[model samples]
Target: MTQTVGKRPAEDMTQVKLNVKWGKETYNDVEVDVSQPPLVFKSQLFALTGVPPDRQKVMIKGALLKDDEWGKSAPKEGMTIMLMGSAEAVPVEAPKNIPKFVEDLPEAEQEHLETKRFGAGLHNLGNTCYMNSTLQCMFAVQPLREALYKKASGAGGDPTGRLVTAIAELFKDLESGGAPFPPYAFLVALRAKFPQFAQQTQGVFAQQDAEECWTNVMYAMREKVKDEDGNPVVDKLFGMRTRLRLKSDESAEEFTEDGMTYTLKVNIEEKTAHVSEGVALGLKEERERSSVAMGRTVVFRGGTSLTALPPFLTLQMMRFFFRRDNGQKAKILKKIPFSLEFDAFEFCSDELKKELEAPRVAYKEAQDREIEAKKLAKKGPGPSAVATASAASGTLTAANAVADVDMKEAAVASTSAPTTSSSTKLSMTGKYELVGVVTHKGRTADSGHYVAWVKQSSDGTWVCFDDDKITVRTEEEVLQLSGGGDWHMAYLLLYRAIMVDMSGAVPAAVSEAAQPAAAMETEGGSSA
Candidate 1:
C-alpha cells in the first residue's frame, strides 16, 4: 500500500519483497512499498511483524530507513530488515514508591516539628500576581492581620464578607509549610465584588493592578470589620490626617488658603531624584480658581501638610505612567533613592512644627542613651552600665532619634515634656522607618511579577517575600530596590514610625524579655 502525500517517493521500486525482524520474531516474505515514502513500509511491517509503526525502527543490512525517503532508504528483495525497537511498550517502573499521605509514611520518615513556620508561597493562578503580591505585603500589617484572623460575619456570604473570609482562610493555609495554596476562593470572591477583574487579558489570564487590588480589598475589609463602638479598624491603622494651606492672588478680598489635601499623589520626575523630593515637589503650589478667595477668578496656590501622622505611612512611588503608543502603564526606569527613615517635618506647616519639639528632645536623649550603652558595653561596665536601652515605642508613634536634630536646626522651640519620677512621657512621633515595600519586576503593572520586602518586627531584618519564596535580605539589598531596570523596583513603600517606651514604665525583666534567657537571668542576678 502506498501512502503518497501529493507525489510518489521514487520511480524504479514498488511492492518489493523483504524479511523483517522485530525482537525475536521473524516475518518472511514481507512486501515493502519502495515507490511510496519509506515510513509506509513500517505500516506493512506492523501487520506481519506485530510491531507498531512508531515502535518499529526498520533497517536494511547496515543502513536504517529514514521517514519519507525511498531511493535513499535501503530496500530490496531478499532483504532482512532488522528492527532495533521493541514490539511491545516497555513498562516504566518508578524508582521509589512514594507514599500518598503523611500518615502512610514510615515513622522515621515522618516529619514532626513542634512549630513549622512556613514561608508560604502563593501559587500564581494565571497572571494574578498583582493580587498575590499586594496581599502578601499587607499581610504583615498588624491591624490587617488582626482583622483577617478575627473577621466577623458581615454581609453573610455576600461578595465583600466572603472576600474577607477567603483572605482569612488563605492566611490559615499560608501559615502551614506544606503546599503552595492557590488564591482560588479569594479570586472568585474578588470577581464577584468587582466584575471588572474577571475581564481577562492575555487570552485566558487576568492581569490586574496590584495597588488597585490592594485598595479594593482594603476597602471591602474595612467595610466588613469595625470596632464595638463602630470605629473602622482599617481607618484607625491606615488613615492619615492631612491639613492643607492655601494662598490667593491679587483682586481677591477674601484671601483664604487653598482647598485641603484629599489625595496622595507623588510624581517622580524630580531634579535630585528622591522620594522625599518627589513628595515635596507634589506639595508645591498649583493654580486653581477658588470660590471664597477668587470670586474674580484670581490665582490660587495651595499646599498640603500632615497635621497628625498615621501609625503606618504608605508612600507610593510614581513610577508608572500611561504610554499612548502601547496603551499600557509603562514603568519609568529612573533610580530613586529610598531611605529606611522618613521625616515629614519639612512637609508640615510652621504651626505644627511646635508640636513635634518636646518629643524630639526626648527621642534624641533616648538615642544618645542607646549609643552610650553600646559604647559602655565595649569598654566593660562603667557609669554607663546603667544606660537605658531603647525599646520600640509600643502603640505610640516615636520619631526617629536622628531626625530630632532637624528640629533643632529648624529653630523649633526646645520645650521638654514634664517627666514623672516613676516614668517618662514618650508621646511624640513622626519619623518613620521602612516597614514593607511592594515592588514590580516587569515593565508594566498589567504584566509583571509583584513582590514584597517586609521588615521583621522581632528584629529589624528585611525579607523579600516574592510570591511564596521568602528570603532574608540585607539593608543594602532593600535600598537598591529603587527602580532603574528590568529587575524588581520599589513601587509602594510602607513606613512604620519609630516608637519608644521608657524602661521605668515597663518592668526590667518584662522589658528585656526579648533578650536571651541566660543574658536576662545574668543581668538580674548581677543587679540583685
Candidate 2:
C-alpha cells in the first residue's frame, strides 16, 4: 500500500513552509516541494540534520512518510513534521555500461577503443598544433602534472597567475574523461604572457614553432610554479649541470668552467644518421677567440661534459637554421635516428662514470636475469636454479664488459665529460627512456604541422596525438619519425630517467647528482 507523493506533475510542484523537529532542535519554516516524492523531502531534512536521506524516518500527524506516496492530503503551509533516525553512510553506485575492456578488443579496435576510453584530444585552433603538441608532451610528465594541479588549482582569478592556473585546469579537464576540447583559455593566457605567440599573418593566425612554444611555456612555468621550499619545479625536472673546458692551442693553457642548461642542443650534420652522433658533435667545437695569455686571437677548443643528469631530459635538434640567402629559418631534411632507451654513460665525465658504475652493473645484472629466465621458459623444461644463476651471471658479465669503443675513441678525440633532489635517487646509471616527442611534418619551420607522440605509462603504448585525432602507434612507427623526406621528424624529444635500485650502492655518493659540480667550480656562461 503505497500512494503517489502528489497528483500534480513535478513541474507543477509548489514550495510550502513546514516546521521540522529533529532531536532537541526545531527548524521553523523549512521549505518543502509538495509534488516531489517523500525521499526528496527526507533529503531536505537530511541537510538540516546530519542524517542521510535513506536513514531519515519522517512523519506528519503520526503518519509515516512513504517515499513514493503523498498520502490523502497534500503538504500544507505551517505543518509540523517529525524527523527521526541517525545519519547512515550511503554506498556509492557503480556506473553502468562502462567502456569495453580494452585488452579484450582486437589490436586494430584497441587503438580506437583506447582513444575513446581516455576521452582526451586537444583541438587545433587554426595553426596552433604547435601549442597543442607541446602541451600534450608536457602533460605526459606525470609528476609535473600533479604538482601543477596541486599548486595552481582554484588560483585562476589573479591575472598574473592565469597561465599556470589555466594549465592546471586544462590538465584537470583532459583527465576528467569526454570529447576533444579546445585549449582556448590556455592559448589566450600564453598569448597574453608572450606577445610573440599572438603574431598573425594578414589578419590570420600564423603557424609557430613547437620548440619555441615549448621553451616559452617552460619559462612561464618556471617563473610561476615553485615548490614548498620555493624552488622552481621546472628546474628540478629539466635542469642539468655541465663542465666546460677551454684550451688555447697556442698557449697550451686550459681553462675550466661550470655551467647549467635546460635543454641539450643537438648539432645535426649531413653525416649525423643517429642522435648520438649529433650529440657527440655538439659537445665539442673549435672556435677562434681573443686569448689573454696569447695576447691575440687564437684557436681554442671548447666542449661540455655532463656533471649531472636531470630527472627529465629535453633534446632539441638543430634542424632549423637562419638561411642568410633568404633571411628565413629553414629546416634540414637529413634523417636522424633516436632510440627508445638512451644510455648517456658515454657523455658523463670520468668522475660521474665512476659514481654511475655500481648502478649500471646492477641494471645490467637485472636485465641479464630477465633475459635468461625468458630463454629458460622457452626451452620447455625448466633449468635448475644453480644453472639459471650461472647463466645469468655469465650474461651479466658479458653485458657489463661491453664498451662502445668507437664512441669512446670519438670522445677521446674531442675531449668531453655531465635535477631533482630526492631521498631515493633516480636515474643513477645515466639512462633515460623516451616518453614523449614533438614532431614536424613540413619542409620549413614556418609551414609545418606539429604532432605529439606520448608513451602511455599504464600500458607502455605510444599514442599519436595529432590535434584532435588520437590513435595508438607501434614503437617502430614512432621510430620512423626520424627525418628522411618531407615527413614528420622528431623536433623535440623528452626522456625520463630510468629508476633502478642497486642494493650495495651508496645513495649519498650521487646525492649531489642533480646539483652542479661545485667541487670543480669555475666561472662560465649559462649553456643553452
Candidate 3:
C-alpha cells in the first residue's frame, strides 16, 4: 500500500530528525529526510534520526508521524527540516598479508620495500659494536718512541715499517692541515715506493752522465715551478744563455744551432758577449741584401727561432731614430763601433755622401736647362706659325716664349721618361718664364673644396691650384672632370714634377743677362 516518491525502491528513502546541542545551548529538533536503506535496522534508526531509541527525548511526535508516515514525512509546521540521500554502502575488502605501513602504497612502489629493508640492515651493521672495534684495531699502532728505539737497537723488523711511520706522520699532518711539506717529499715518496731505483745510480761517475742528470733535474724543477699550462712562473728567472755573432762589415745577428750564415762580431775581451753594433750592422746588411734580391723587404724578427723584442724598447728606439732623422739632428751612436772599416760607419758615410751630392747634381742639371731655355729665348720667335701666333699675343715676351718652349720639351721628356715597374705616371711641362703644370686625379666634389692640381714656377716656386691664384696672376684653375673620383691623375702629374725637379732639371728659363746678377745677389744675400 506504500508508494515511493520516485522510481527508487522504498528501502532507498528514509526520514530522520536530528536534535543538536552545542555547549549549553540546545538547538531545535530538526527532521532530516534521506533516500537510502539502512545496513542495520537499529543502527539506521540512530544514524537517520540522530537519536538513540533507548535515550529519553523531550519531543515526541507519534501522532504527526501517523498522518504522513505512509507518504512524505512532514514535520510540524513550525519546525525546520533537512533532506539527504542515503547511498548504498561501498564494500571495503581487507588487504591480504600486506604490511601495515604499505597499505596505502601502489603495487609498483611497494616493490622498493625490499631495497629499504636491505639498507636498514646495512645501516644497523655500520653502527654495531664490532665495526667500531675493527676500525680502532686497524688504526692502533706502537708508539713512535718505542718503534724508533727498537729500530736503533737493531731489532729485526720489516723494511716497510719506515713507510708506515712516514705515512702515519703524513696523515697526522694532513689532519692538522699545518705547515707545508718539504720539496724533497716527492723524492722521498719515490724512493720509498721503488727502493731499487737508487741502485741504478751506483758505479756511474762520468761527467757527461752527471751533466745529463743535472739537466734532467733542472728541467724537472722548472716544470714543477711552472703553472698548470707549463709556462714559466717567472720568465726572466728561467731564461737560457744564448750567443750572437757580429761581422765586421755586416749587421749583428743571432746565432742559431741551425747552419745559417751570420755576420756577428765576437768581443775578444768578453768571450761570452757579442758586439751589439757589429751584430746590428750585419743583420741590417743581410736584410738589405735579401730585400733587394727578393724585390721586397723580408721581415726577420719573427718565426719559431726568434722572439719579439720588448715593446717598450722597440717603441722608444723607433721614436728616437725617426725624430732624429726627420729633424735632421746630429745623432750620437754611442754604443756603435767607430772604426772606419765598420760596415755601419761605411753605410752611414755612403748615405751622407749621396745626400750631399744630390743637391749639387740637381743644381747642375737645372743650370744646364736654364742655359738652354735662355738660348731658345734669344732665338726671338721661331719660324713655326704657332710661334708667330704666340709672338703676336701680347702675353708672349721673348723670355715667355722661351719658357713655353722649355715647358713643352720638359713635358715631352717626362712622358717619354723610363720609370720603375710601379703603377704611376709622370708629366712635366713649363716654359722658362711660365709656370710648370702637374695634374693628377682630382678628389670627388664631396671630398672638400680644394683643387687637386699643382703648379711650379720657372724659378722652382711651387703652388697648389687652390692657392695658385694668389701666387701667380695668370694661373688658370682647372676643375676636376673625371666622374670616378680617382685622385691618381693628380698624383701622376705631381710625381712627374717631383722626379724632374729632384733631377735638378729646369723646366723653364730666364735670360742669361739676368742669371749671373741674380746668382751673385742670392749668394751675397745668403752670405749676409
lDDT of each: 0.59, 0.68, 0.25
The TM-score ranking, best first, is: 2, 1, 3
Tens digit of per-residue lDDT, candidate 2, span 97-121: 9787768667745544547655478
Candidate 3 similarity to native, TM-score: 0.14
Could you tell me which residue pairs clash in candidate 1?
A: 121-468, 246-257, 246-258, 393-499, 393-500
| Model 2, runs deviating above 4 Å | 1-113, 117-119, 154-160, 287-289, 380-427, 504-528
| Best candidate (score: TM-score) | 2
Which residue pairs in candidate 2 have backbone atoms (N, alpha carbon, C) closer than 3 angstroms, thus clashing? 3-69, 4-69, 4-70, 5-70, 305-418, 306-418, 307-418, 308-418, 348-417, 349-417
Candidate 1 Cα deviation (angstroms), residue 376: 0.8
Q: How many collisions per candidate? A: 5, 10, 29
Tell me the tens digit of each residue's lDDT in model 3 across 1-528.
Answer: 111111234453344444433234344543333332111212223333334323312222332222113234333323432222222345889879967767677674465343321111111111121111111111111122222232323322223333333333333432232222221222233233333322221222111111122223323323333322333221212121122222222323332331211112211122222233333433342222233434554433411111111000000010012244445322112221121011111212232233324433543455564455556667765655445344333221222222212111111111223221121111111111212222222222111122222222224333332211112222323223211243322111111101112211222222332221121111000110
Question: Cα miss at 429, model 1 (Å)?
Answer: 1.7
Better by lDDT, candidate 3 or 1: 1
Q: What would the per-residue lDDT of candidate 1 be over residues 171-279, giving only the tens digit for each residue?
A: 7766664444556566656766877776654335457777788778878877887655455556545555555556665643332342322224567783647888888
